[model samples]
Target chain A: MENDGMQNGNENGRESAQSLAASPLEVHDLTVSYNRRPVLWDIDFTVPEGKLIAVVGPNGAGKSTLIKAAMGLIPSASGYVRFFGRDLSESRQRVAYVPQRTTVDWDFPTDALDVVLMGRYGRLRLFQRPRRADVEAAHQALQKVGMEQFANRQISQLSGGQQQRVFLARALAQDAELYLMDEPFAGVDAATEAAIVELLRQMRASGKTVIVVHHDLQTVQDYFDWVLLLNMRLIAFGPMETTFTNELLQKTYGGRLSLLTEVADLMRHEQRKERDPL
Target chain B: MSESQLLDFFLLRQYNIRVVVLGTVLLGIGSAAIGCFAFLRKRSLVGDAVAHAALPGVAVAFMLTGTKNPAVFLVGAAIAGWLSMVAMDAIVRRSKIREDAAIGIVLSVFFGLGILLLTRIQKSGAADQAGLDKFLFGQAASLVTADVMVFGAVSLGLVVGLALLHKEFKTISFNSDFAHSIGLPVRGLELAMTTMLVLAVVVGIQAVGVVLMAAMLITPAAAARYWTDRLTVMILLASIFGAIAGYSGALVSYLAPRMPTGPWIVTAGTLIFLISLLAAPRRGMVARGLRNRRNSRKTLEENILKTLYQLGEEQGGMFNLRTASDVARRRRIPESQALRGLGLLRRSGFVEQANNGWKLTQEGETQGRRVTRLHRLWEVYLTEQVSIAPDHVHDDAESIEHVLTPELELQLEALLNRPTSDPHQRAIPYH
Candidate 1:
């Protein structure tokens, strides 16, 4: 059954490749809502393979929601995500995901090596345990990220950069064709950021795809090959040289600045009214 | 000591011992297994609430049925215990009350209601009324072989359930978000965990007594954490500790007739906890303190080496005690400790006294330069990567210098673009 799933997934992937040669990931007319209100609307874009792509937007610009929707992590109101011409689940084993570091508990008792081994779980049968081969793979991944020495160290004892590298190693251990990283650079030291960028470059050189949700605009040009500028909809999606312009930045972040400030003021007004009644 | 008397004791009194020992062991195993997960989940206090909540259920069962059958009362106790858990969760979910506060509120209120019901039951005058009173503080001497068998079966069931779902439980506890993302049915797994917790609590109430059952659930797990970080090891250690406590408690209660089984078990659990608290290798307080002291001594030695390196760079070779003391003062070391640190450094052959002054040996010079190199590299990193101001980097880098590994120093050098100078434009010698 597992082999059949892989075979079917590969066929679907081939078909998708033929349809969109320029874009390995294609999202069409995507919308996402939360609690009856739309957070992302009318999104459409495509990312080509083997490029270091950045999903850039302001704080409330649905950047995370867009990635979540694409990964089938959140319930989308409408739209379809095609990965190499296949549905998300069909190509599950081929895609790797790294969530925000804050989303996990660092105090969890597992050591650095244990977490990296989890990347192999997707390929393993439900009841099967991780084997010696998996452990060796994990060690190799850790070495690539320069965390080999700390493999036996408890995760809680690591510094921020080391912790982030551990997560990267786990993702590398997955050996997936496409990588989806959520704010891999956030809260990390510069050395960690450099290491991750180098790793991503290596992944690109190996013909694997890498997409990251990046926060710092200054490093965007240096880090990513392609940029997906977003604000509720696709502002622009193309090579960074062609799409990253001041005008596109203004359009994504312009109107919301004053509007968000006004909402904050109104909230403060309502809170005051509740407290003072006058 | 008579033969018949001994026979009577063995035959008649032996049943009590069997019941108490078996019940305590089963309860210990069940509660410890669930407790391992609860301890990891940071919901250790919830076990306390469930144990306390069972009181009202037992009381209500006796009130309604006018019978103190262990089966009937335990059913009611389990329902009430589970309901109290639900209520505690609801209060936290719906209200602004924190989880601990909710637990405290539900625990005291349910227990208070149980006491009220117990008083009412006493007023009603029933033949089986005496049996209900034993639930307050467990009367292990009154336990029969049937009760032991029931407890054993329930505990075995919990153990099997936990064994089957160990990986899923671990995934959920460590990273619930990832578990959810991977389509692991996190909610169902959580419910399974909670159900096991309820089962552990209900099965334990008759043996350990409601008042002390929470300790049995939490203490063993807490102690086990000091011994191992792996979940399986932690659970196994906890179960073994619990079983020992159970057996010892029952044995003591049987031999001395005056002591209650519940208190004896609690005492045994506490003893294990105290032993773990003082002795466990990694997380134990004493071990951590000893490690800290060793690290501090290493730091002090490193500081002396760094001081000698600075003197060598300045005078082109070595420095005296006065200059060393002055440098140590600038580094915030007291005069007495600084002198002691210098003595240790001299004794260690990293430094030597010549012409009433201290000078770094050839080996000392090499170590000193490495320390200085690490310090400057860190300063450069702090300024270039972390965006710290050049002037502000030295103080922080001073402390970080002692801890930076050789590999990290190399990474820093690469990251800083192999700068030959510190942020302050001082020449950083790299060998």
Candidate 2:
């Protein structure tokens, strides 16, 4: 029995190694537009498995749009996201996404445990409620985030950090191999930031890939192992130590300031013309 | 009246009572079920629009068919109501007009057209059209067995559909983006919810007129919110309230010969709303006021204890009650409460009577200095990091000090760079 267990472990390790060699998340020549105006130019990148990656860019640099496009939440002009060597639709069960904290209504009449149980809805039948096993998994997820005491509390009563922890708990209950979180650290307290970083580290340690859209350049080194620098186009994609530098940051954020400013001005001008009809 | 006389009056001549009871029950259940989702989505007025929009359809149906068949008129009304809702949505989406404005526009235009049609039909020499006009205000006492069956079937269908699609409806209402991301058909779910709303309104029009339907949709849900923070409980409570109002309205209209059922139903709904508003446990207005008053009294008592402790800390482990009173004056606490508060402090061992004056006990001094430290720390944090004006910082700090947990105080300390003095350069007392 011991030998068989060892063999099983060995096979799992080899399978993971082969999967990592062929990137788990691959975006190929992706281009997106809003109303026929380019937002993201042709972009291509691949995120290897079991790594904590950060996608960092300036505001309006398509940081959020990139994640939304990849998740198939929004229509893309031309591109596709492959998950585990398949399209996103085919392998959606193996993926989990945590949207921005502000996107959900806090005043909704649900407790912390109820929201976490939503993660199991994809696995359960449409008309069914969460089973005992699903409930246990939700409880375990809450415990992992140190929010077990708040499971029965109304979501409206939670502080900002507690709310973010609940979102994380929901994602944890999904038990997916790949996680995509959009700005988990934004507006959170320092303790929550540390806790979330630690959670992501644990996910990476468990041989699961986690991609986070992050702000705050100073904490990038402390949080993420891999980095994808974007400025509406693929600026660079590699290990943080190799690709994250002043030159790349300048190219991604600094040099395009005037061009972005011009585009925004033109958009405003077009909007005014449409409104006035003169 | 004699027993036999009363029996005859109730048993045989009390057909109106039966109609009222049955009609109210169905109307209440149906409206409350649909109202729960409408309230949740913050589209409480959509029911109002659809109800009013049905009026013209009812009149038009009568004018075309030349009959008072409730089913035919109701079907016509439902089609009209649904079309108006669709038009309103399209206008809001295509144009820059806000949803509220679009609802107002659609409601008034469609309803005005309905009134015009009713007036024209009445003038066209059809005596049966007189009864059709009663639908505008509702005549619940006139409901027959057929009407009850229609309402019961429709209400049952809505409730069952809601039960089957409960999870999907909740997901879509609470978080549309998340629903879409998870491959839930968001548009289909929304359309299903809207269809249920239209059906509820169509069933309710015979009992409550279009003008009063909004009250039925909004009141029960608003009342239910005061009782529980769970969706299932809220929906159940709302349905019960709705049913009570519906039944009462029907009963009143039956007992009184000429009274309209819609207004009576609305009156019952309003009464339930008033009870929930004042009597609910957590979110009720009266409960919140009581909690606020209790918290204020506690804050005052904590302040008095801290002031006495501060006096003891300054005067080397002992101070007279006069000195504590003077410190309270500096903190702007009223002298009368301060005295009464000092007496309570003495009972609690925070202070003791000695030589015709009060002095802090060991425990009292520890707590006083801690409050003082919290106040000074908050003052420093506000003026240094938050960049509040020095004068503005003191008032905020004074209020915040009482609520600051040790964990939060530490975060404030780190955020303010661990300053030893306030912006005024006064030394901050520390434990």
Candidate 3:
């Protein structure tokens, strides 16, 4: 059954490639709602392969929500997201997600190496333990992030930079073609920042796609080749040189879209009414 | 009971004793295994609510079936427990009430309803309903061989189920979104985990009772967390702790005629938790207190060394008889503290007491200069790299000087490019 699904996906991928070379990620008219109120609205974009993309916006702009919705971590209200011309379920092995560092409890009873080993779980059969090769791959991932010495250390004992590196190492162990990271440099030290940059450069050199939810505007031009300017809606998205203009950034961050916000507020008010039905 | 009687009870020679102990031990292991996930998920109190909700089911099953068959009570309890969880989730999602409030509502309402039904059943004057009240406070003494066999089998099944899905549980418990993004069927796995948790509660309810059963579920896992940071090891330790609690509880109740088994078991679990909280190596309160004391002592010693080094510089780098009172007044420290600091330095060969006061030996001078250098180097690094104001750097440098290792000192030195002095314009001391 799984083979049939994979073959169908491959055929579909080939057909899409014939028309317009299939980008690494494609989302069309995607709208996501939480608690009956929309968080991301009518998002549409296509991401080029083998480029470092930064999704930049202000707080509550649904930057993490976009990545999560595209990966099917949360259900979309309307529209669809396709990866390599296929649904997420069909292409999960080719994609990896690095959630925010604060999303997990570091006090969970696990060491750095064990966390990295989780990256290989998607490839294993049900009820199967990680084999020796998986452990070796996890170790290699740890080494790549310069965290091998601390691999045996409890996760809670790690400093902020070290914890970020461990998270990055987990993503690297996945060996996915596309990596979506949320605020990887949020609290990391300079060394970890450099290590992450080097890792991203290597990934791009090897023809893999990376999309990061970036908060620092200064490094946007220097680090990313492509930019997706978002504020509850896609303001602009393209190569950084052409798309990351002063006007677009001003639009994304300037809070000039008050009409949109007002409409969203009205919709939320109605949603509450519908839920309560009194 | 005498010591020999205690020995015989512990040896499992008595059939009834063996049955009760085995039942409670299996109950402990099962609750703890599933409880680890619940505890990690921050749903520790949910077990308490679920166990409490099962009480009404017990009364309802007894009223309807008019028999004490354990299977009927199990099914009834499972359904009620599941319903309470569902209600709690629905209330949280559909209303402005938060999860804790929703849980509070469901736990109390169901528990209250159970009490009402239990009182009604008592008023009904039915035969074989005499011991149904024991479910409120468990009567492990009433547990027969057949009851032990059934409870043990179910508990074993729950534990084995957890083992089979250990990786899935770990992933979801750690990061649910990552698990979902990886196509791990996170919701279905959560449902499976919840089902096992319900089964665990159901199996243990007869031995620990609904009132105290939550302690069995959570205490062992919380205690085990202090011992290790590996999920598998934590689960293993939790199981062992749970078993020990069960064994001791059973033994105590067996030996004492009037003692209730449920309270004894809960007390044992609490005792284990207290021991782990106070004595476990890395996470324990005692170990942390000791570590804090050592750090503070090192800081104090370094401060005294720096004081001595400055005093020597003022005296043209010659040994002088500096009384403890003089040093204490200069450093603004208590005289007793100065004496203690000097005593420690003396033992370490950093200072020697003469007739008038304490003096720094040649080795003491070198050691004192190293601490001073470290203090100055950190101040420079903070001002230069961390961008702290020159005036704001001294206090931080004071505490950090004692903790900075040799490698960090080298890095700070290189980073500062061998600055001759700190931002304070004081000449950087060197050994």
DockQ, candidate no. 2:
0.49
**Residue A39 error, candidate 2, Å:** 3.3
lDDT tens readout by residue for model 3, A70-155? 98877899988888878888899999999999889999999999999999999987678999999999999999999999989989
Candidates sorted on lDDT, descending = 3, 2, 1
Best by lDDT: 3
Query: Which structure is stronger by TM-score: 1 or 2?
Result: 2
TM-score of chain A of each: 0.85, 0.86, 0.92
CA deviation > 4 Å runs, candidate 3: A1-18, B256-258
Model 2 chain B worst lDDT window (10 residues)? B5-14
Residue A246 Cα positional deviation in candidate 3, in Å, after optimal superposition: 0.9
Where does model 1 exceed 4 Å of error? A1-52, A69-96, A123-128, A131-151, A169-179, A198-211, A221-226, A232-243, A257-278, B1-15, B92-98, B255-260, B308-333, B351-373, B376-390, B409-431
Task: Give the per-residue lDDT of model 2 (tens digit) for B1-431.
Answer: 36764454346456646665777787798789779989999999899999999999898888888988889888988999899989999988777799999999999999999989988988888877667766777778778888888888888988888888888888888877777666677888898899989988877887788779888888999899889999999989999999999877876665664677788899999999999999899788999999998778767767876776555556654555544467557668677777777777778787787766677777877777778778888888777667788888878877888899999878877787777877777666666
Question: Model 2 reaches what TM-score against the true structure?
Answer: 0.87
Higher-lDDT candidate among 2 and 3? 3
Question: How many Å off is the CA of A8 in candidate 1?
Answer: 32
Please, what are the lDDT tens digits per residue for candidate 1 over residues B1-431? 36764454446456565577778787788888889889888998898889889999998887788776778877998899899989998998766699999999999999899888888888877666876656666766667777887788888988988888876788778877556544566788888888888888877777677888888889999899889867788899999998888777776656665556778888999999999998899788899899999888878878778877776566564544435566566567787776777778788888787666566777777777888888888888888878999889888877898899888788788878889888777678877
**Poorly placed runs, candidate 2 (over 4 Å):** A1-23, A29-38, A255-257, A260-277, B1-16, B316-319, B323-328, B334-340, B343-370, B373-397, B405-431
- What root-mean-square deviation over C-alphas does model 3 reach? 4.2
lDDT of 3 by residue, B131-249 (tens): 77777867777788878888789778878888889999999999999888777888889999888888888778777788988998899999999988889999999998888888877
lDDT of model 3 at residue A195?
A: 89
- The lowest-lDDT stretch of 10 consecutive residues in candidate 1 chain A is A1-10
